[model samples]
Target: MTKADLIESVYLKTGFSKKESAEIVELVFDLIKTTLEKGEKIKIAGFGNFVVKEKDSRRGRNPQTGDEIEISSRRILTFKPSQVLKGAINDSNA
Candidate 1:
């Protein structure tokens, strides 16, 4: 869901004003972004973990042209869901 949808959910669940809900959601997102920017990880009790991983520059080949290219180094964010979350998702699908 989009940010607005999340804000709406917060509003409905918490009985918060729309403006207040938006502010709360924005603040939570900003905190997550700032933490990730520092290359740290976040772990929620039953949700999952958010990790930042770094990759070094590497050599790659072009698919069609058969030419070698250098892949740039970068940092990536990844999420690993907790077992509880995985079970919930599987149960819902079933």
Candidate 2:
């Protein structure tokens, strides 16, 4: 589902207007992004962990021209779902 869908769900569950729901969802996303930008991790109970991982520069090959290239170092955000979330996803009722 998209962000709009998520905002709608929040609106339905909390009896908030569409605009307020969108703001709430946006605020949550902004908080997550800001936290990740600070090189920190967020762990939500029964949901998952959001981690920022760092990778060193590396050599990579171009698939088309077969030329070697230098891949720049970067930080990546990753998520690992909690066991409960995984179970919920695999549940038949879902």
Highest-TM-score candidate: 1
Clashes of 2: 0
The Cα error of candidate 1 at residue 34, in Å, is 0.4
Tell me the lDDT of model 1 at 71: 95
Off by more than 4 A, model 2: none
lDDT, candidate 1, residue 19?
Answer: 100
For all candidates, the clash counts are 0, 0
lDDT of each: 0.98, 0.97
Off by over 4 Å in 1: none
Q: What's the residue-level lDDT of 92 in candidate 1? A: 100
lDDT tens per residue, model 2, 1-94: 9999999999999999999999999999999999999999999999999999999999999999999999999998899999999999899576
Task: Estimate TM-scores for all models.
Answer: 0.95, 0.93
lDDT assessment of candidate 1: 0.98
**Residue-by-residue lDDT tens digits, candidate 1, 40-79:** 9999978999999999999999999999999999999999
